[model samples]
Target chain A: GAGVSQSPSNKVTEKGKDVELRCDPISGHTALYWYRQSLGQGLEFLIYFQGNSAPDKSGLPSDRFSAERTGGSVSTLTIQRTQQEDSAVYLCASSRPGSNEKLFFGSGTQLSVL
Target chain B: SQQGEEDPQALSIQEGENATMNCSYKTSINNLQWYRQNSGRGLVHLILIRSNEREKHSGRLRVTLDTSKKSSSLLITASRAADTASYFCATDVRRDKIIFGKGTRLHILP
Candidate 1:
């Protein structure tokens, strides 16, 4: 892929509905990241996957939020029983190991929980 | 939670003027990067300054890093309306865990 790709660019789900957002990182990029951001606000780290290592989950806000990255290429962020607070843009970024925070970002998924 | 804190949460300037934003982090960093986001989505990498480097420049953008203070600043010279966007500063803690600040919302008035 030329750049990171995110699916269902915009989504509106009723409160309590479960929704899944997907991300396909650049080819051969071994690192993938998920972040949550309110409109015009800073990014909130959600989770990160680096190669085959156990993902760093310290940033998950609650039990309702979970994510998985399979095959080290595509990653999914799942929000269960979504609440209105879950409404925000979910961004995905990828970088190679030791890139020193040089991240390539996707456009993002705007998830609106009504 | 975000480790970096950007100052002047929002800034507005007329076109042709300059815009400066600062970011402060709490820990040792491998490097610091600045990114821009338009319409609140899609981040465009602007520049990165390694811990050992003090300053770097790219086009109209100038970045300065001070490891002693754990701070960095981005200066956009001769700003334009196209520069209107949210500017973010990010730092890497380890292999690939890059943490970001909320960002400074910059609006260039035409």
Candidate 2:
């Protein structure tokens, strides 16, 4: 893909349901990141992936949120027992190693928990 | 919080005027970056300034960093109506991850 791609641009789920959001980073990019943004709020870091390993998961809000990356390319963010507070736009970004921190972003998935 | 936070949650300006947005962070960083988002979509990288570099320029965008103060600013010269978007500041505090601020909404009126 020419740019970062994310699936299911919009999702509506009921409370207690589990949801999975997928991210396909730009080809050959070695770094991938997930962020969450609520209405009228700043982006909150959720996770970071370098290859298949996540060096930092400290940002994950709670046990209900988890993510994984495979093949150094696609990544998935899963939220368990979704709550209304979990509703937000999830953004994904990718960057090359030593690219001066330049990141390419995807359109993002708007998750709405009812 | 490694993510930088921008000031002035919103700003409205007339086209052709210069608009400036400021960001401040809490920790040391390797570099600071600016991004633009339109209508709550994906963000577009605008400019980046390394900790050592005081300033950088990209077309009409000028970014300045004050590492000693842990702050950075983005200046858009001669803003256009098309420039209306939300501006974000992110800090490259850790390797492979950048922390992003809430963002400043910019409205450039024609």
Candidate 3:
């Protein structure tokens, strides 16, 4: 793809339901990131993947939030037993090898937990 | 937790005027980057400044970073209506992950 892509632009789920969000990063990019943004809030780092190595999941908010990157390209973020506080826009980004490389972001999935 | 915070949560200005947004971060960083978002969608990278460097310019955008003060600023010269968007500052602190600020909403009135 020309840029990072996220599926199911919008999702509405009830409390205690489990939801999964997907992301497809740009071809050949070695770095991928997931971020969460609530209404009128800053982007919160969730996870990061560099190639197929172990992911950096330091930012995952709780045990209910988990993610995986398959084949070093597409990624999935799963939230278990969703809570109203879990409602937010989940963003995905990809970048080249270097640390200062520019990041290409996806449109993001807006999850609303009722 | 957020690594940076942008001042002036919202600003409105005439189209031809310059728009400036400031960001301050905690802890050290390898590089600082500026991004723009329109209509609450994805973000677009604008400019980046390395920790070793003080300033960088791209077209009408100028970015400056001060490591000692742990702060950065984005300046858009002769802004246009198209430049109306929320500007964010992200810091690459070490190799962990990029931390973003709450962002400053810019409204350029035509």
Candidate 4:
């Protein structure tokens, strides 16, 4: 892909339901990141993947939130027993190597838990 | 949590005027970057300034970084209606992780 891609641009699910969001990063990019943004709020880092190494899961909000990057290309974010406060736009970005490298972002998945 | 804070949460300006936004961070950083986002859209990288560099220019955008003060500023000259969007500043600390600010909303009026 020419840029980062996310699936299901908008999602509305009932509270306590599980939701899965997908992301496809650009080819050959070694770094990928997941973030959540509340309305009019700053981005909250969720996780990071560098190649196939151990993912940086330090930012995952809680045990209900988990993510995985398969084959270093596509990634998925899963939220179990979602809460109303969990509603937000989940963003994915990819970069070349270093943290300072420019990040290409996807349009994001707006998950709404009603 | 966010690593940086941006001031003037919102700014409304007429086209052709300059728009400036400031960002301040706590810890030392390797580099700082500026990004723009339209409504419900992904962020677009605008400019980046390395710790070793003080200032950089790209088209109508100018970015300045002061590592000593742990602050940075982005200046958009001759802004246009198309420039109406949310501006964000991200910091890369030691190449570990990238942290973003709350962002400044700029509304360029025609």
- Tens-digit lDDT string for candidate 1 (A1-114): 799999989999999999999999998888888999986689998888887454589998999998888887898899999999999999999987656456899999999998
Tell me the deviation in Å of residue B45 in model 4.
Answer: 0.4
**Per-candidate TM-score against the hidden true structure:** 0.96, 0.97, 0.96, 0.97
Give me the TM-scores of chain B across the candidates: 0.98, 0.96, 0.97, 0.96
lDDT of 1 by residue, B55-94 (tens): 9999999999999999999999999999999999999876
**Candidate 2: tens digits of C-alpha lDDT, residues A1-114:** 999999889999999999999999999998899999888677888889988899999999999999999888899999999999999999999998756379999999999999
Taking the tens digit of each residue's C-alpha lDDT, what string does model 4 give over A1-114?
A: 788999999999999999999999999888888889999988888888887653467889999998888898898899999999999999999988654469999999999999
Q: Which scores better on TM-score, 2 or 3?
A: 2
Docking class of 2: medium
Q: What C-alpha lDDT values do all the predictions have?
A: 0.90, 0.91, 0.90, 0.90
Q: List the residue pairs that clash in candidate 3.
A: none
lDDT by residue for model 3 (A82-108), tens: 999999999999888765458899999
Candidate 1, RMSD to the unseen true structure: 1.1
RMSD from true fold, candidate 4: 1.2
Candidate 4: clashing pairs of residues: none
- Note the chain A TM-score of all models in turn: 0.94, 0.97, 0.95, 0.94
lDDT of 4 at A22: 96
